[model samples]
Target: MSENITLTVNGEPREVEQGTTGTDLFGGDKAVLVMRIDGELRDLFREIPDGASVEPVTAQDPEGLAVLRHSAAHVLAQAVQQINPSAKLGIGPPVTDGFYYDFDVAEAFTPDDLKKLEKAMQRIVNEGQTFNRRVITDAEGLEELAHEPYKCELIGLKGNAANAAEGAEAEVGGGELTIYDNVRRDGTVAWGDLCRGPHVPSTKVLGNAFKLMRSAAAYWRGSEKNPQLQRIYGTAWPTKDELKAYLERLAEAEKRDHRKLGAELDLFSFPENIGPGLPVFHPKGGIIKREMEDYVRRRHIEEGFSYVGTPHIAKEDLFYTSGHLPYYADGMFPPLDVDGQNYRLKAMNCPMHNEIFRSRGRSYRELPLRFFEFGTVYRDEKSGVLSGLTRVRMITQDDSHSYVTPEQAPGEIKHLLDFILGLLRDFGMNDFYLELSTRDVDGDKKDKFIGTDEQWDIATKVLSDVALESGLELVPDPGGAAFYGPKISVQARDAIGRTWQMSTIQYDFNQPARFGLEYQAADGSRQQPVMVHSAKFGSIERFLGVLVEHYAGAFPAWLAPVQVLAVPVAEEYYDYLQDVAMKLREAGVRVEVDMSDDRFPKKIRNASKSKAPFILIAGEEDRDNGAVSFRFRDGSQKNGVPVADAIAEITRVITERQNTDPTAG
Candidate 1:
């Protein structure tokens, strides 16, 4: 008689035969792509351990989706090998919304090649080939992957995968070496790769809901010094409808890309003369930026924050004191030697803000002291990573710091969270979730962080508690905290459903001690104040980029660079429109008048292209009637409105700072 093993299946105790596998429990459910036993993802064919907790991972789950994508990547690799037998493989990992596989091939993949690869992958997906995992020793792996140099290198760097390359984890991230083989119905090996995988049971599980997006050149292990391989990008979904929807969202996102919109709207540009990641805002973009700055500054003051200023450069020792020099040196530019002193461009404002806090002694009455600034900082961002405004070297942060006693930490964090959310909502970003980034106490790089374990635990709990109480979806990000302490980052979804990390509030107990910042308590005892770092707009440039994409470059009336553009019915009505524009200008509207040689229709078209919230059109009838016609951004028109009413309506929208469409009924 076979012995029965006790297992906790989905929180319920169950008895199964000793040799029972996950397939025995969940094979009937096609949605169950993989299983998690003892909190680690495993193949369905793997036997369940006695007394272990088990849960089915379906295609709809995040981990299940990653497994599906990884399986699709394997199919893609198989298809590539079928096409070009000489192609060597690199690591294939599932990333956000997709997976990518690197290949060392003779030539760069072209559009036609991608099409061919897709067809091949579909055939492989239809073949119903089973994925079989086998454990192997280092020598065995080296021998089996002798033809693939990258795989051998990964095997050699098994424990230290981080030093190898970016996606190397997918290949050698496990405790032991293993290879996944694509086996045919007859039990013959079709293809194989060195991997640490919990792939879908079979290639057929991928179905036709996978696509080969494109191919690009990527360095091996993400190092420029290494050989460049052609990386094929792809996405996988549980259903065809989901795949279609994802593609549609991608199309819409491309249309709303900030870089493209910035160029077409004449908002901002990255001039080659100024170098990469440095953007110059045009007059239109400047207007939006100035408005943002003014509004945020006013809100900070209203929220009991004192506006402060800091220099662009500081001595190197200050960063060392702040513990940013060694940990954050990669993101900072090289230091400048000024009269035998090393002066470095500031990558953050917290160290300088710490100086201000330590500049004076404080009492417990000023418990939650807050300081805010619009500090422009520079980073040494890699050229490859630089995007239009979102990933720039020059970042203007609405940075703030709150100094409070340990007892006031939670409340202060709650206040900062509320302020951050409110500011985001005011800017038309209402959809949000929170992420709690905590220290990696068990990680290999634990020395990189500073603080006692007790301090870290208290700080993390304070942030986590506040985030959970806010009733928003909170995601845990272990090993993603700053060197000093944990943080709560606000991830906001834009119009197209793409999430961006907008604002953050970090709880730091180490910095105050490092800076020797103290406040006198009521008991006449001095205590180190806890520093909470908050950035309402993580960076002005990045926030503007997000807003540009969020609004699709058609900003609301209040944010529109040219709030009102006056177009003449003809060159004769130019004076009538100019008079109306002057009235609007006097009313504090950013108004412009079309007094060019262009035809009336051309002028109206130009106004429409400008994305002006309101357009005032004057003709002979309007000039004689002491009225002007209103043309809105949606192409709707209201004719014969009194000049006074037009000015009042526009002023009202701007004064109220309405973010909705002004023309909406």
Candidate 2:
């Protein structure tokens, strides 16, 4: 008689044969791609331990999707090798929405090459080869993967995979080395690769939902010091429909790309003479920027924040005092020698803010001291990562710092959170979720973060509690916190359901102590104050980029650079429209009249292309009636409105900050 073992399967107690595997427990469910045993994902074919907690991981789950993509990457690598036998493997890892496998080949892959590889990969997927995992020693891994120098090097760094490379953790980690072999029905190994994985049972799980994206040159292990390799990117989905949906989203995102809109609208430009990652806003762009700054500055003043300013560069020792020099040194520009001392461009404004706080004495009555600034800071971002305004070297931050007693930290954080949410809503971003970023206490880089266990726990709990109280969906981001403290970041989704990290409220317990900042408590004893850092718009440049994409360049009337453009229906109506434009300009509207030799229709087309929120048209009927036709975005028109009513309606939309098309109703 076969013995049976008791197990908790998906939160239910069950009995199965002692040697039962995940494949046996979940074989009937085609949606289940893998199994989670004691919180770790495992292959379905792996045997389950007695009394172990087992849960089915479906392809719809995030982890299972990653496993599916990783398996597809292996198949992709196999297809590459089959075509180009001389190609050597680097590393293949699942990234956001897809997977990429790097190869050391003689030639870069072309579009035709990708199509050929897709066909080859489809054949492998049809073969339904089983993914068989095998454990091996370091010596065996080195010997078996000798032809792949990159793999051999990764094997050599098995235990310290975190320090090895960006994606090396997907290949080898602090455990016994393993290799996954693609086994055919004849019990013959078709291909294999060194990886630490929990893959799906077979290539069939990938289905026909995978596609080869494109190929690019990437440095081995993500370092310029290493050899460059041809990296092929691909994406996989659970079903064909999901893949199609993802492709559609990609198309939509491409249409809404901010860089393309910024150039087409002549809003901003990254001139080569000004250097990469530095954007110079055109006059039109400057107007929008000014409006945003003016609104945010007024809101800050109303929220009890004192406006302040700080220099662009400061002594390097000041960063060391704030614990940014040694920890965040890489993000800062190289130090400049000034007056026999090292002066560095500020990558952050908190250190200087701390100096301002320490420059005075405080009492508990003024516990929540808030200081705000529109500080422009510089960072040494790599050229590879720079993407127009989204990722730039020069960033204008609406940075603020609040110093409070330990007991007052929670309330102050909540206040900031409310402020941030309201500010985002004012800009038409209503969808939001909060992220609680905490320290990674168990990670190898724990030493990089400085704080006592008790301090970190207290700070994290305060932020977590306040974020939960806000009633927004909270997501946890482990290892994403600043070196000094934990943070609550507001993640706002744009019009297309894409999330962006817009604002942040960080609970800092270390900076106060590092700077020796203190306040007199109610008991008349000196107590260390907790410092909170908040950025309503993380950076003006990045926020503007996001806004451009969110609105697709058709900004609301309040934010539009050219709020109203008056175009005459004929050359004779030019004087009437010019008069209307002058009236609008007097009413504090950014209005312009088209008085050029272009045709009336051409002028209207130009106004539409400029993305003006409201267009005023005057003709013979309007000239006699003392009215104008109000044309808006969306090709809708409201005709024959009195000039006074037209002006009132336009000014009302702008004053109310209406984000929708004014004439949509």
Candidate number of the best lDDT? 2
TM-scores for every candidate against the unseen true structure = 0.96, 0.97
* Poorly placed runs, candidate 1 (over 4 Å): 1-4
Please list all clashing residue pairs in model 2, or write none if there are none: none
Candidate 2 ranges with C-alpha deviation above 4 Å: none
Over 349-377, each residue of candidate 1 has an lDDT whose tens digit, in order, gives 99999999889889999979999999999
Q: What are the root-mean-square deviations of the candidates from the true structure over C-alphas?
A: 2.0, 1.7
lDDT of all predictions: 0.92, 0.93
Candidate 1, residue 619: Cα displacement in angstroms equals 2.5
Model 2: how far residue 629 lies from native, Å = 1.6
Tell me the lDDT of model 1 at 273: 95
